[model samples]
Target: MSTESNSRGNHSAENGSSVHHVVQIDASFLSEVEGKMEELPRLLNRSAGRDSCCIFRVPQSLSEINERAYQPHIVSIGPFHHGEPQFQMIQEHKWRFLSDLLLRAESKRVVLKDFFEAVAPMEEPIRKSYSETLEFDGQDLIRMMVLDGCFIIELFCKVGRIVPADLDDPLFTMAWVLPFLMRDLLRLENQIPYFVLQKLFDLSVGSGNDDPSLAKLALGFFNYMVQRPLHVLVKYYEKKGVHLLDLFLMSYIPDCEEEVRRPSRFLHLIQCAKKLNQAGVRFKPRKTHSILDIKFKNGVLEIPVLTMDDFWSSLFLNFVAFEQCYRHSTKYVTTYATLMGCLINTPADAGFLRDHKIIENYFGTDKEVARFFNNVGKDVVFDIHRSYLSKVFEEVNEYYQNDWHVRWAGFRHKYFDTPWSFMSAVAATVLLLLTMIQAFYAVFAYQNPPKNH
Candidate 1:
């Protein structure tokens, strides 16, 4: 485990126990997701739920937080603030995936065509006049990024024949590409940038397949496992009373950043320890996906930077920084309830549950989580997976009014007993707004003249 102390050499952990980090992740916890076959129905429920999400295998490092205690009741639902939904959520469950909903949209086919026209060459800086269709001239930066995305998904999800014997096979080199690609990825806008990446591919076999996006997501997670949390790695080692930050980073950081393969800005994180030391800040061991609970507060403020490994994790880190780093962070508001869910689950499922108590422990209480999820619609969670199926297959009701999602939301709500399906629907409603905008623009253009300009 590479850590911060080793890098700073001889720095003392004078008040180790009191270092209350703004976050805490049981890295060991996420690995247990494969065994979560039972928790799904409860989390994806359409009604008020009381299923305990307590995993049997959490690291003993921390005690089980008393489940947020609150009376379950009816609550109203609302829109998705989350980025594009993941493909895994689609292929495994069919229409439940947002991609399918996107498919159901009126201008879906056209939008997809537009998406392809803007993206499809497997090569980068696509030849403006390439006679061949779907073929890129050569690997451009975008193409390289797309490849990296595929490469990562191949590592985390489609890792064929990756057994215990090959888990550490240096050849895979997932870390090398993760940070390099992500740093560049952050430089652009979200949806449009993804549109470009999507267009560059030729998924003739499965036209609507979003395997690349799934790959991008998984790689994002793998990168977090490999890097960015070195400071936390240091804290972890410190807890065990052994320091190895310098040696660990020197040994693996270079490989993770792939400075040997391709020089990148990521290398600076590894080589620039002196500057961080001068500034007197270092990342503590990862508590929960790079978020940790620090007890020691010696006036050293924690800064937030996106960790290339986990998209959700990076978002959570920034979310915490928004509270801890911001000077205006209200003194009354120490932690938000949803942060706990983000800490415990994937980015997609943040506050998606119908039960509020499950998310309130780290955040504050059951009521708070319910209020947050209520802001989005209910369709995201289902009691039996049946509602999910029904909602996903339903045609995009074009006749529905602007607040139709809200209007149709009647079953038990999130705040009280609101139906989870309607809530998710509301969220989908907002995300799908762009399509409506495009339609309006097209209609306006057809009606008005270009006027010989």
Candidate 2:
């Protein structure tokens, strides 16, 4: 009887423990469901009021095309890629930059603490600008803004020649690093708010006679990297940008012309430069630094010279990614890339542009240069009707579509495409010229007979 009672009691105890475990799990799941249910209304409200997203993840569809171009290799700029293990190498450099900035401001008695104070209050507004709610709390986000903003200012200062570089500075002394850093800084996900940097600039370095506006400084830095003059965009300096990436985007747009209306969608498969050359379309190099200054008028297609090197892909891909994520942003860069892709379908097309001085290929082969454009627009969806290049595309396509243009192109390719054929044509021209001169002399002698006198 005692054994039976003990067994029964043990069984009852085991059953109770099992029941308790099940109840606990049920309670935890119910709590989670309730929490999500409670947050639905607030989430909807937040979604409705969202205006612009400063930083964005490169769309996975585009990223999968070439992950390296969308991702940072040597450095990560902002909070999205922050704490990444591979990017940790640059964190020390960022800290060093921060230290240098503090020391430079020592005379003004500005410390790191001052940066924190300025950034902390602006944290909420800054967060509001991001499309996705950040996983970081206020303190963490502020710290990131402070550190990243200072690093960028210091970099721009160095690049803009506003300040002298310290001895053994990696950014100045290590040549390869500058390109990577510049590429990384322009990534869509790799950016901090420009206002934070500007605020920090005022707090640490007063806006005095020598201190330039942040726009000027940023333009200077971009111009240095691109080796193009972006001074035309100085008028738009007072315009607000969400971050450094947006500032970079804004630099490409020229002031709107009153006469020209941008179309929504333009054709892409216009004749290549080589074909266009045959059709009597003149390719002239525009001396402007604005990348979007492509204009087609009266058979002349004016395009700014584009330099292609190892770093161009990284810089360009990031710009396209930004256009992809933002609805309100203009698709200028995307349109340009698509146009280039259409125009440069092969090495022959790239060589034609290179010969015309419209494209300056720094170190890449013609095929590689051609490939850059051909692959750049993959997975990026754009409405041609709303594109800045729509009008240019329409004009170019219309011009190339003429019956005369096609016949002329065919004539050139058949008769004058090869060197031997061109030489043959030149020889025939010389012979014809001699014959015409002989005929003219004979006629003159017969008509005048004045040579005898």
Instruction: Say which candidate scores most in lDDT.
Output: 2
Which candidate number has the best TM-score? 2
Clashing pairs in 2: 264-384, 264-385, 264-386, 265-384, 265-385
TM-score of candidate 1 on Cα atoms, chains taken together: 0.19
Query: What TM-score does structure 2 among the candidates reach?
Result: 0.79
TM-scores, all candidates, are 0.19, 0.79
* Model 2 lDDT tens row, 1-453: 367766776787888843122223578898999898776342223532456455777777888777888777778776678898998878888898888789888889888888898788887778766656677888888888888888888888877777888768766788888878888878787877778888988876677777688877876776657765445756766665778778877877765431344442335547678777777677888977676789899878999888887667777888888877766677778888888888898999999889989888984899988878888888888666666666777888778767887787777777688999899988999999999999999999898886544
Quote the positional error of residue 220 for candidate 1 in Å: 11
Tell how far residue 100 is off in model 1, in angstroms: 28
What overall lDDT goes with each candidate model?
Answer: 0.28, 0.77
RMSD, one per candidate, in order: 30.9, 9.3
Task: Put down candidate 1 lDDT per residue, 1-453, tens digits, no spaces.
Answer: 236644333243453433332345576776576567544333223221112110111111211221111100111000011113342221232222223223333243433344333445523223211111222234233433343333322333323222122444433455653343332222111111222223322231122453333323323333554554444333322121000111121222111110122232221111111222223322223234323222113312232222222333233222222223222222111222222222323222323221222222344343543333232111122121122111211111111212444333322233223456666867777778978999999999999969995
State model 2's lDDT: 0.77
